[model samples]
Target: MNFDLQGRVAVVTGGASGIGLAVSRAAADQDMAVAVLDNNAQAVEAATAELQDRGFKCLGLVVDVTESESVARAVADVEASLGSIDALVACAGISQNTPVVDMSDEEWDRLVAVNQRGVFTVAREIGRRMVARGSGAMVVIGSTDTIGGHINHAAYAATKHAVAGFVQSAAIEWGRAGVRINVVAPGAVDTPLLRTKFDDETAQRVLLYNVPMGRLSRPAEQANASLFLLSDAASYVTGTTLCVDGGLTTGFFYNDQVH
Candidate 1:
């Protein structure tokens, strides 16, 4: 029952918006020093300020997860400002719905650069330090698409699958060193990303297709799941992907509640 992490420090990438922001706040609520890392300088600064105004201890760092130097500098800054890192939640990702036929070389590369390479870069960098310290936890954000196929989601699914694999392998490699790695695969969340992707009617159809709850998930709901995994509550849990999708992917359920 010693899940307390009040005196620890954590890093959350893409912490300026959507689910990332919620996760960062959850870490802060547990009284951890949170570093809000993002590629947008202004967004990071603003998010940091907002969190601080809410009386949470936080720092905003502009970082490009795709760049090693950028990630290195940001991690160092977190260490210098908040002491040894206790946890890391990498939620930075980009989504594009494109069929394989419509996907261009540039688009594919860019998506992989941000969604696939970015997770590896951040996790590898932070995980190395954690391994050296012999204590830490990490959470990588994924999607329902990680488990199944979706129309126009080739690149996104591919990257999410990479994240799933990374979590499993990294957990096994680092478990003996006292480090834990896991993934939180969320369903269709009501975030700016989803808002931009679909209009009112299309959104209902796309988001609620197989969702037993008949509603999109909130970012805070996903954050809560991630917080549990990052905390000592999940000390024995690793290399697992906790689906926060509200039964959206539970195939072949009764539709008796419908109509």
Candidate 2:
């Protein structure tokens, strides 16, 4: 099946690095006019320039997803300068791994602010525009941790679960209006963010033991999933979380004895 996104305009949050950057590049590769929104001004400028050097129609804007006003301004800027936003990929988020009992109010609040609330802010603003235009698609980057609880990740998991709910509810409400909302729940991807979680040896062992694929997922893999969800190829898909977790959520176990 063809996954053509030619002439489309896509806005990706947290697009300066990690999964967001990868998705931005993928969208550009598909000939879509792309914009990268990040809180880091330098990074956003650099990334946007790099993509432009590579012959992609791109723009960069500094945005703090946690603030509704900031999000609205950024979306407005993109719409005014970059043409109508055909797709929005809410890839901006943060993660924390504090145990539930040890988690502080601040930690929980920060995670919710950046992850769940950020998602809400971006989706709401973009969804409003999409509804006004009567057509659009949104892909939210979530986590597989939301499926089966992970140790020391209560705050992160909670936000991801909320994302799922938001996607479903939004989809139900907006589907008939020619809009689609979906979530891409990634497993342990080998991005800079994941690298910060553990030492090399420990990270490898964890992936080998837990991930059925026996390795961390690549950023490109997740980007591909996002691209599909955002493209017309997935026109009929909405309100669903596509788990691109390398079989992590499918259930795997360790056996004491070797076969």
Candidate 3:
């Protein structure tokens, strides 16, 4: 399906790598002018260079989403360089696997800052413009943990839950303003983030065991979902969390080979 996104401008937070990078590339592939925002300056340079080499209009900026002033500056820069933002994909986030009892105050606060506040900061910064302009689309990267419970993911899951709630509220408030907001909840995506959380064996024994697809999702797969949500095809879609998991949240898949 044509995304009807050509010549538009898109800003992707955490677009330097992983699913965010994939989304940035996909948006550029659809002929959208892309702005990549990330905290890691080196990764931002590399990603932007790669996209430019591929003949896509791309800009990379070092942005700390946790800081509202930093986000404001980045947003202003994106607008100044690329034009009015037509789309935003809030994919900047971090993950940790410490159990709640064993989690430290620093760890919890850090998770909340990056995962929770980062999403809110970027969305709000861009959302205000979208609301004023009366046209925009946004997709936040959520997780299966947003809906289901997970062990050793207390803080991460909490932040994702908060994101889900924020999307719902934003959708309600922004719907009349022609600004759409939604989320893509991925399960066991094959990104660096996932690899750090589970090794090959542990992934199979712990995470993949519950997946009916019996495989992990690719970063592009998640990006595809985000792209759709950001496209005109999803103009009527907002304030929803679309799960891109490979049936990981459907239920436990017992491989007993029942005949």
In terms of lDDT, which candidate is strongest? Answer: 3
Return the top candidate by TM-score.
Answer: 3
TM-score of 2: 0.94
lDDT per residue for candidate 1 within 140-220, as digits (tens), equals 999987787677778888889988998999999999999999999998888887787677778676567678888889998
Q: What are the runs in model 1 whose C-alpha is more than 4 Å off? A: 1-3, 252-259
Off by over 4 Å in 3: 196-199, 252-259
lDDT against the true structure, each candidate: 0.87, 0.88, 0.91
Give the distance in Å from residue 54's predicted Cα in candidate 2 to where it truly belongs: 0.7
lDDT of 2 by residue, 1-259 (tens): 2469889999999999999999998999999999899999998989999999999999899999999999999888998888999999999998875668998999999999999999999999989989989999999999886565666778898899988998999999999999999999988788887787656677666655666687888998999999898887889999999999878778742221221
In candidate 3, list every pair of residues with a backbone clash.
none
TM-scores of all candidate predictions against the true structure: 0.94, 0.94, 0.95
* Candidate 2 residue runs with Cα over 4 Å from true position: 252-259
Listed per candidate, the RMSD to the true structure in angstroms reads 3.3, 3.0, 3.3
How many clashes show up per model?
Answer: 0, 0, 0
Question: Cα miss at 80, model 3 (Å)?
Answer: 0.6
